[model samples]
Target: MKDTDTAEETSPEPKGVNLFGVDPLIIQDHYEIDYRHSYAQDSPFFVGLSKGDLLGSRCTGCQYMYATPRSHCMECGATTTWEKLPLIGRVHTFTVCYYGGESFLKETPFILVLVEFQNVNTLFLSRLKSIAPEEVHIGLPIRPRFTKAPTFRVTDVWFEPMGST
Candidate 1:
């Protein structure tokens, strides 16, 4: 949820990549830039993204680990420290977007999801990769895939069905 009149508000064109001689659509630049410069800066999310690790913020005081870093803990209101979490989790929620704001992403129907780690309830919002929409389930296991973006230092977070390899 964002206010319409923010300083960063700008319309962006979609991006595409040559995937094995085929052009694959990407998210719109406006949305991508908004996400990169906004909530991601202060958090260790980018750090993990760069290192190909799924990082989270943990309340050192309460040992509550969150998939994405936050300034403070939701449970205890204490400062959080970054922790690298395992990429394994179960899908908690998901949605298939038929219409992507960006023309690039609009080419293919994509799945957005919230996944929860095993033994821990911490959830991370991400996209499903290389999986069919019909195969996705509320409790399907998944693992992270760090897309190697050579042009950008920060790797992108994508997910695959567990045992996908």
Candidate 2:
């Protein structure tokens, strides 16, 4: 056989060290992916926020109202229809969040509120802004503010104490 061919066949394979040994190893990495999804029946709610409107759902059979969108009625198992919700509502309840999900982690210690509107059967959950957590109360007047350029996300709308700019 040729010298070059014999050398190639006999060369040892390369090896890597097991740097981690018996201990657990950690490797930091950044991962991201583009995800596409459809809101289907709830599309109108997000669309309304983009146009500076808040949309809710009402039961067709029982006339029960929801401050948040619902495809079906929880009260009577009936279908729901879209309804325009009032811009103003009152704080039904509230809490100061010391920990949050990844998107809100940097804004820790924020306030979340359950907003109640007149004639609406259910309360809407939203982030509260422009006020200290201690200032929030059971009946504090609140109003929703929309993002000028909406991303069709729940984050597009938030609540603030009424009369604040």
Tell me how candidate 1 scores on lDDT.
Answer: 0.74
Query: Which parts of model 1 are misplaced by more than 4 Å?
Result: 1-43, 103-107, 150-155
- TM-score of every candidate relative to the true structure: 0.68, 0.84
lDDT of 1 by residue, 45-163 (tens): 76567668777777867877787667788998988887778868889999987877654374469898888986454778878878889999999989988866632332277788988
- Per-residue accuracy of model 2 over 1-165 as CA lDDT, tens digit each: 675687657765434535346434679999999999999999999999999999999999999999998999998999999999998999999999999999999988999999999999999999999998778899999999999989999999999999799
| Model 2, position 98: C-alpha lDDT score | 98
Which lDDT values do the candidates have, in the order given?
0.74, 0.92
How far out, in Å, is residue 149 in model 2? Answer: 1.1
